[model samples]
Target: MRKFSLYMASICLLFGCEETIDVELKDAPPAYVVDAWINDKMETQVIQLSLTQPYFDSSEPTPITGATVTVTSEGKTFSFTESQSGSYTWDPATSTDRIETVGSRYTLTVNVDGNEFMAESELRRVPPVDSIKFTFKEERNAFQPEGYYAEFLATDPVGPGDTYWIKAIKNGIPLNNPFDLNIAYDAGFNEGGNIDGVVFIQPIQDAVTPLNEDLDEIVPYKLGDSLHVEIHSITHEAFTFLQQVQIQTQRDGGFDEIFAEPLENVSSNIMMMNENPDVQVIGFFNVSSVSGRGRKLTE
Candidate 1:
């Protein structure tokens, strides 16, 4: 009788171990990062299917190796070849060597490791320059009783959000860098956080030793001084961040997984105008808002 009982107990233990080791199924697709951009000096150009590695929180970016990417437009097909693991180059000879025009639509298809991805975007057009003007600001100084500030005002007649870049040239030679003046604040409850402003600090040169008695010898910004203000063509980093979050959330399953993405696209686009390149416009501005309220905190 004891032998019989021992045999039953052994059978139960063996079955319990098998049950604990049962296989579980996961239905999630492999995550990937893809960065597509137009090459420098060419506005109508697009270099697509460049696989960026998965970010700190993102799934590994989809690899471009052995992947197929094609763009079709106006009856012409352009193909991209993966030159390396995550980067693909277009062959101008066979690819459509053309510029994407503003207001025109384009489609792109990418197949990586048998997974397909696609998107469409319009070549945006910026409004022509209406006017570039400046104004003076007043502030009290810690070293002096009073101080004067110089500020600039720009308009498009059409309104704000047209991206603009500022470049300033002082004393003849063209400055090497461009300054971006658009300043954005984080969304806060009380201040609306949407109010836009510029912060500028001027550098004062020391008076020459044994200098002349003329304290009124003044230097002024002259007209035709080559103040290069160019309309910026790059997509705003904020837009890119929001876009990535939207895409990741749509693809991911868990709530915490969806919230792990970063909130910055800070690619030299958010710098003060008074620094290195002297304050010239290299871009335009176009302000837009996402209509609905953000996701609820309770859920």
Candidate 2:
């Protein structure tokens, strides 16, 4: 069992949140896997490089070491040194300046093992979470307990296509199950509506609550429960990738699986710099701007 789910942990290279999910590969030959994404928060940023392994060989993904990784924005380049196996880091502790800025374009360059890959992303803006509030549900259904349920209040900026990944953190842990993953378009889900510049819609807002371990039931917060909500502004491409992932990785079993579409690879933004068109890389790179709020559920 890996630490967490979503493309973020396995991919922390996924959303790069220091959590990882269990992913099993099929009978394909090994390919380079780049789990790289970054944020505008002033902290140590990371990019992970690895190689895909056998489906049954579930120790850990083999690390791709000794790679030169750098991110350049507005002509200034920040180098990431390999801090550990396959994981590279750029610490801003020495300097007060952060690497990325909102609306600025960023370029990623990776050179290793006679292969070079390049990618580009823009640091997008995020709407701030005004507050987190919880309400006590007096009725206990078969689905959930009679306790406090939490939701955050924050309006999407007055614009279209403002995609966001809403992370619901309870206590000290992230509710990062594959089913727990929640993303929004504008102020809602993909319903083909112009729902911008408003607080997040019901389903999207309600997703802050997580499901049980089996992913079969909802778990509400209780008295004294700590609730933290974060909005990670992602690219439209990253949004689409997550959309596909949530669809593909959903745990709906039985008849659902029978009628499900054949599994295929999700998309990636990382690509080879040279014309070695045969090599396939998996993963994405997005420069995100995050906004958040936190508090506890009290009586």
Candidate 3:
């Protein structure tokens, strides 16, 4: 009887009980997504509208059309014309001298199918990039042998709540990876560092380099590679939004399976004026003053 029980136990360990449970996932109604931005430049401002799709659906989100868009600031209103299917443009060349000014607040309003959404942002001043420096170092677990990387030398203005978004362009190609998203809450290396009025720290400086998507590694630049860095003064809300986006992008298979942030919608500045609960909106509206500098890597 003991031998028979042992054999049964072995069998159970090898091929235990199994069952398939059916999960019914109800698809939520589609919501509108708005991508709006206004920079301190003498150019046309653009607003893009689209509808969100299901998670498993592999198609592009449908664009919203026939919407009326307008931007207002300091008692002046500039209307936008639909230039494409889902794109609206406000050309300051035709109506005004410039659309955005430093320290000026702007409000955006969009009316679609009798539903109205509004957002407001201010164009803040960005510190200029004094210079860019590159160095090659050999370190443990490095991707390349004494890989080359660039850093910006710029002093952050003395302020507690100042935020910046740094963008890197390599040979005229913009780096758009989540790993390449570089943002600074203050002059410090990370949040609450309080290293104000000084040069940005090493960790923040190293973020200017691009990353390899396949291996999830930082890619170093080669000699003669042209690098352009643009630093934009962003609102605290915009900084928070980009931080959340970075978290979402970094959470992949293993880490995501073990410890992952709960899936939540990104915060949007746009709001429905009618207080309609049924209508959902996504994305953000941003206004920024940009400062940039470029350099060619050598040695």
Scored by TM-score, the top model is 2
Show where candidate 1 strays beyond 4 Å.
1-30, 43-63, 91-96, 127-299
**The candidate that achieves the highest lDDT relative to the unseen native structure:** 2
Q: What is the C-alpha RMSD of each candidate to the true structure, in Å?
A: 20.3, 9.5, 6.4
lDDT of 2 by residue, 1-299 (tens): 33334323334443535543455655877889988888877788999999987757778899999999999887687899999999999888865557556889888999988899988888888998998878888757778777778888889899798888889889989987899889998998963878989988888888898888877668888787898898998989989989999988875775356467767788999989777766777889988898888998776
- Per-model lDDT: 0.36, 0.83, 0.81
lDDT of 3: 0.81
Q: Candidate 1's residue-wise lDDT over 1-299, tens digit each?
A: 65765466556665763223333445333334445543223323334343333234366455446777666556656576676776766755453355345544445566655455554444443333233333232433432222221222332223223222222333333333111122222111112433222221111011100111232222223333323333333334534443343443333233344246544322222222233332221111122211111111110
Query: Which ten residues in a row are the worst by lDDT in model 3?
Result: 250-259
Model 2 poorest 10 in a row by lDDT? 1-10
Task: Give all TM-scores, in the order shown.
Answer: 0.38, 0.88, 0.86
Question: Model 2 clash tally?
Answer: 9
The order by descending TM-score is: 2, 3, 1
lDDT rank order: 2, 3, 1
Where does model 2 exceed 4 Å of error?
1-26
Who is ahead in TM-score, 2 or 3?
2
Per-prediction count of colliding residue pairs? 31, 9, 0
